[model samples]
Target: MQINKRHQVSPYLVFFIIYNSQVGVGILGFQRTIAAKAGYDAWIGVIIAGSFVQVFIWMMYKLLAKADGDIVDVHSKMLGNLLGSVPSFVIMIYYWLASVSVILSFIEIIQVWMFPTLPSWILCSLILGLVYYCVSGGFRVVVGVSFLSFIIPQLLFIVLYLYPLKSAHFSNLLPILNHSYKELFDAVKSSMYTIAGTETLLMFYPFIREVKSSKKFAHLGVLFTTILYTISAIISFTFYSESQLKETIWPELSLTKVIRLSY
Candidate 1:
């Protein structure tokens, strides 16, 4: 399905969409899970995981450039319709699962932190309603909303992470290379699973105003996300002790609890 030229977005806009999608859900608590195995070494795992994303982004661009089509079309050409669409089905299913995971995580956060009395079904319905409204507006609306999501969070990131630095023990990040290579690799794998939405580029590639520029923007998105995650992991690990980190479900959120602004 070709996206009409009229509905397409600037290649630069791809950066924000990629930012919004990858930064969702997982970053909140991923530090704890990755650190569970590697301890403070998890920050290194974040850089390694981002490197994997860079390689994948490069590979995706090369493949799309060569195939000159979206993933579905490429699959159809390579595998007959029956075989080709199997991969598309798998990709769509991955998307659906990731979406559900993100939504459920946010609902859990609300339940635990804000409104224990709020019905999950009601929250789910409201979210689905918002999804429907966005879908009804078409892809442009989706992109616009995602762009705003990326923009609006800049202040929050600063407030949440920077303000906590006063109490953060940068010393906690020491003894960093203490973990074995295998431990680091396992942590990287855990982080990668959370960052897996980059495949979304395959679908939006056809809608880019300039394909080459979009590819660059896509890599930038990954790089930016990598830095963000890496720094976040460091902050979380530093702000919490090894045992505290293991016990905390959302280290990133915990950072916000310590946030202070000097008068």
Candidate 2:
């Protein structure tokens, strides 16, 4: 539980970690699932889901700060090591399953668009191997990777949005509150799963250099991602009709097809 200062990363990096965790494979196609339930009003659901994540982040910081350790430590404190391991094991299994799901989703995307002949197992293995190497290096190394992961794709994503904007039907978002409350809630529920990775904070809280100051950065990261996702959802809604979005698996990825460069 006592992490050496050398192993701890700066509080500011927590923003990148939070951002990196929350925006993964889910963002690519979540617009469809949410819009399916609440129509264009689904962007509202994204904001609602993000508000919930902010509260969850606050709860995590409070709990972790009290225990002065990660979730495993908190569990052990509450239920002795013997009983605590059960829930901890379950949590680890959940993380394992989630990781596999994300990896497989990403692999499927690659195979569909880039490498139809690539075997899933081989790609999966290579990805896991890279993950193992980075993780084995230590938490600081992992944090460094998270920082790069947050930084590298930003410009490309911004450019991808330009093409979609030109063809967008802004009227698609008109009748925003037309959906019933139940439908909007369903959209919120789905958006919650898409933006769910903020829980990673539970595992890394102890590794942060200044826990108190990091709290604000963590919240700010959530705020930024929330806005990004909302904009993405709105863009997809405006660019594709509701029915077309339902048929498109990766609306965000499909947006890239519209981009053309002049020589």
Please name the candidate that would achieve the greatest TM-score relative to the true structure. Answer: 2
Candidate 2 residue spans exceeding 4 A from truth = none
Candidate 1 lDDT over 62-112, as tens digits, reads 888777778988898889899999999998898898889888998999899
**Candidate 2 overall Cα lDDT vs. reference?**
0.93
- The per-residue C-alpha lDDT of model 1 at residue 73 equals 81
Best by lDDT: 2
Total backbone clashes of candidate 1, pairs 3 or more residues apart or in separate chains: 0
**Candidate 1, residue 120: CA error in Å?**
1.0
lDDT values for all models: 0.86, 0.93
